[model samples]
Target: MSCSCSSSTNTQNELHASIMQKINNHPCYSQDAHQHYARIHVAVAPACNIQCNYCNRKYDCSNESRPGVTSYKLSPEEAVKKVLHVGGLIQQLSVVGIAGPGDGLANPKQTFETFSLLKKYAPDIKLCLSTNGLMIHKHIDEIAKYNIEHVTVTLNSVDETGEIGSKIYPWVFYEHKKHRGVEGAKLLLEKQLLGIQMLVERGILVKVNSVLIPGVNDEHLPFVARKVKELGVFIQNVMPIISKPEYGTKFGLDGVPSATHKQLMKAQEACDVNVKLMRHCRQCRADAVGLLGEDRSDEFFKESFADKSFEELAHHYDLNQRMKTHENIETWRRALRAANGKINQEEATNKDELSSNGNTMLVAVTTRGNGLINDHFGSAKEFLIYEAGDKAIKFIMHRKVENSYCMGKENCNGTYPIEEIKNALSDCHLLLTQKIGDCPQKELESIHLTCDESFADEPIEISVLKGVRKHFFTAS
Candidate 1:
């Protein structure tokens, strides 16, 4: 009963009809769908039963951007209204869900209440819920009752001996009893697996989110991936653990280092499961708004729209306009896919372009996907990593950015983590994007990296091949 994926990447063309329909516009589930769709999370759940070594929930932490952190926690009533207001403004907004400042299932009353109201009001927007999986077995019937088609379970480890889980999660509270050590770990694992199976049986799409913690569960995730895939799980997202010292979590305080881009890719490559690896995750905040990696929660506070009714905000939701916008996006995407197909024919020729006596280096590309260098450097959330040289031009993997260089006019102060971006691309020789401001261009140049915008609308592989030759093959 496993999906028929020939490779690790999931393509709309290869997806089954049922799976495709569920992920067509869900940003979290589909790699391609994310480029054109938007999603939002309402922080209605504020209780958790299990304590992880890497978590320290910060309610009203406006500066730090990560899961278990939110600027405000809204009641079920306020949450439904926020959805209506945001859905009207962002025509591309397709999914609304509750991902926590705490575990959603732990606060079942608030979680289901939010679902009931959103179901009653904004039926067109798909419903998503993320939880710890400790309570899912207890409430699968109610979840089915609400018709929640999408669910995310955070299953960090799959070690049956509970050794790996003991390192990641310290304790668990179930059925009014607190358990610690290996016992707690085993109980949590059993519940998570059972709940995931129940969800699959009910025909619900399940996405397993596992944090890649170094020395803790990094070596154990391959087993986790295989187990979930065997259990009819839809997809598996392997995310890097964020353990900043300021977050005050156990790992952060104990000086456990955060996973680097290279380490994450290595773990992902090591897994090699048929289940798709999600490379676009930004490790979004619990109450995140707007597209991936971009948080605009501050823009739509309760005080900002306290007087607006659901009907008043709902009036602005334009189905016709959304349809038109999506149509335009689809047209360009189709062209992009056609162009990228050239890789099959052109790749054979490029493999030995400079094989005998040429230098090889890594190059980073910024694109919104259409086989074109169309995304601006400051706005790109990911850099498509590729290996290029006289020998060949091949895509290796993608690297995700924690933040974008540009937010907007009022917030664009030219000091948006330029150094961080530089470090992320340090090994690469060149960066290709639609455009970049002089400030970043100069910063990147200081690291001996060249930035080019000349191939703004050109096909990615062809442009990359040419750019590599022009810099390394030609006489200066």
Candidate 2:
């Protein structure tokens, strides 16, 4: 009995190690890789087969970053040309994906052709496919044929009754026809379930993207997480819906509000224990061309790279150099883990003292992700929140700031979304950031939230522990 259990444990460990190795440099799939690697999505598939109330495919909408919005569409040949050109320029370019201004599987020919061209030209770069999963079951073999290993399926509901799904997806075009209402929802759900299972069966890493639609399917996402975990999903990204009316979606036009930072937290908190939750998702554009948070699509629009041939562009790819850079990144990541472990150990040592009298508080931090208080206030797109005091300093959840306060002073002139940011962090007791301007700082304090800048660039866990000890435990 002991030997059997030991063998099973060893198998699980080996499987986990293999998965980790594959995702070690995949930006969207791994939190550790997110800061170091880059991913690009080509908008070659211009036709979508399903309709979601929240999605409005807009072309040349460069101001916003969201799924189904692209500056320009590319052909299979143009996509490969751009990939080679960008891969040459961006050493960290790890995964080439087709996330769409439309559905990936819907335009199967263009989707697979791009992957095929990349395989023939730049085999070292990885391939990824993101789709609605309505037709994913049918394309699993094709997905595997091109050596594509990473797949993302946006699955919002697992309610067998399709009651929850109906509110989100009004229709799904499958089998040469459009199915509507509950029937469409049921069909879409069935396909997503089967496709996810098949993708797992073939040993492809699967990431499920479920949009947090506040009133519609927000309460039902914990169940979605549980179902996806059962389907052997490698990771899950619970992205908040971007329903601003200017984007021109049905939900937006009807005035359906987007999910607040708190509502998103409530949903993710319930699901993260069951499956790894991706809080760092930028909900990237179809033509997004850089690191997760940055967009560089404009630089590579067709004409700029039209003259660069495969060999000329491939020469600069240099996978060996990329691997070396990734090794250095891993070294940094390992050191970060060790430092965090030490902080946690020290916090544990003082756990009894901390619990004796300190007032527990929720502290928010700004980070660029190597476990440091690095990002600045008014510029942070997201905040790393933590529960510090009494118990161990624990990461609660990351809250997304809908709009940045300001990028530069010239851009700030009464336009920094300071009010929005303040409302997002209203419940927090303290905000830890690299720096903050006096105006926003004073406004934040009005809500009883204090800003601390003394621990800038320090290890986040260490800073959180000291802050809690100083403010809540020791007398001023």
Candidate 3:
């Protein structure tokens, strides 16, 4: 349950140093940034034996997908091609994570094949994988063989009977039998701890992601943290439980999310360890592609996979295209955007409907970033808004250029006036812009609009309409 770190002039040392430097210096990991969008996750696993109440295999952590949402399932070879295609387009391929709508280990054949192919084709790519840790103990050798540097296991509680704990995973097929309740929890925990010990012993970094649920495991997180740190885990990411009320879980009832930043911070302070908090972590989609804070759904569609039809890709991956919901469209959009690809507006209709009718959509778009779209938008001097029924309106008054800002000259194509932009959105049912902070709240409320903060451009969405709310804002 302990690990030793010694500095040496070995290749591993150099590699670790390089990776660490990249993480620390990268814009995606910057402390001041409100969102981090550097990593990409691919859900190659389609089935899981164990389940947690807080998790719905139907959807991803970001709530971008529901269980059985996608119709695409690529073979490892196809996945590798897709990674290469995406990596080539994205600047910092910081981490390639294999998380799941199901357990990664449960799909060992696909998981390992994907990892092996990534190593073969994108060796320099930093590797990451998330699991429930039920089958991690069995895959330590394979994980190490691929030189995986980071691994995350979702551990909500230690003791099965403790507060903040639930026997959510009723049963798991272990040796082909249903192991339920405490037995399943114990089995999962045992494998988790063993996996942590093995990874640390082998010099691989470990991170434990605990979803803090109030009255459930909120009180028990300190125990989880202390235990993980003792096992030489480097970071403890205490994530808030994302509850979906429509999914019929006790957790998401009352429309309130579990825990708060303040509560999680308090727990971290109490844990009293060298564990670092992953504040910018985005519980991304299984097939998410983007930098740390930005979403590139549009880019992914336009660029990386533009040649591949959505239906064809879905069928190839064995995704259920027929039952594919609005969630699937968003997931596709997000993936495309991450890859700097362009999404055909005409084809995005079905996906657009997945969004709520009254939902306000804000797109913090700029052409100035150090990416491919620099030429698409002429200058970074003006911001533009494309409403559903109106022509693209330009905000000339808000023009100002800044340096090193993700939405600025080096990072974005340009800037634009805020007031002028708002005026243009006045007639639209919803306003989608690079940001809305500069816009007057009275203007947004006047339009009966709500906002989607996940547009990757705007950092905040304050509704002027009393009681109306905005959800999922990702600050750049």
Best by lDDT: 2
lDDT of candidate 3 vs native? 0.53
The estimated TM-scores of all candidates read 0.84, 0.90, 0.59
Q: Could you tell me which 10 consecutive residues in candidate 2 have the lowest summed lDDT?
A: 345-354
- TM-score winner among the candidates? 2
Cα TM-score of candidate 3: 0.59
How well is each residue in 91-209 modelled by candidate 2, as lDDT tens digits? 77889999998999999999999999999988878899999999988888899999888999999999999888888888889888999999999999999999999999999999999
CA lDDT scores, all candidates in order = 0.81, 0.84, 0.53
Steric clash pairs (candidate 2): none
List of clashing residue pairs for candidate 1? 354-390
Off by over 4 Å in 1: 1-15, 342-362, 367-418, 436-450, 457-476
Candidate 2: Cα lDDT at 167: 88
Which residue runs of candidate 2 sit more than 4 Å off their true CA positions?
A: 342-360, 368-371, 390-403, 412-417, 473-476
User: Per-residue alpha-carbon lDDT of model 1 for 1-476, expressed as tens digits?
Assistant: 24556353355454577778888888888766666678899999989999999999887787767889898889998998888888878777889979998999999999999999988878788899998899899999989999899999999988888888888888999999998989999999999999999999998999989999988888888888899889988888888889988889999999998998788877876665446566667677888888764578878899755578777766766556766876777787677667655431222223355333546667799987545788999888679877676545765567776677887788777568777788899888989899999988999999999899998978787778778777776752
Q: Please tell me which model should have the higher lDDT, number 1 or number 2.
A: 2
TM-score of 1: 0.84
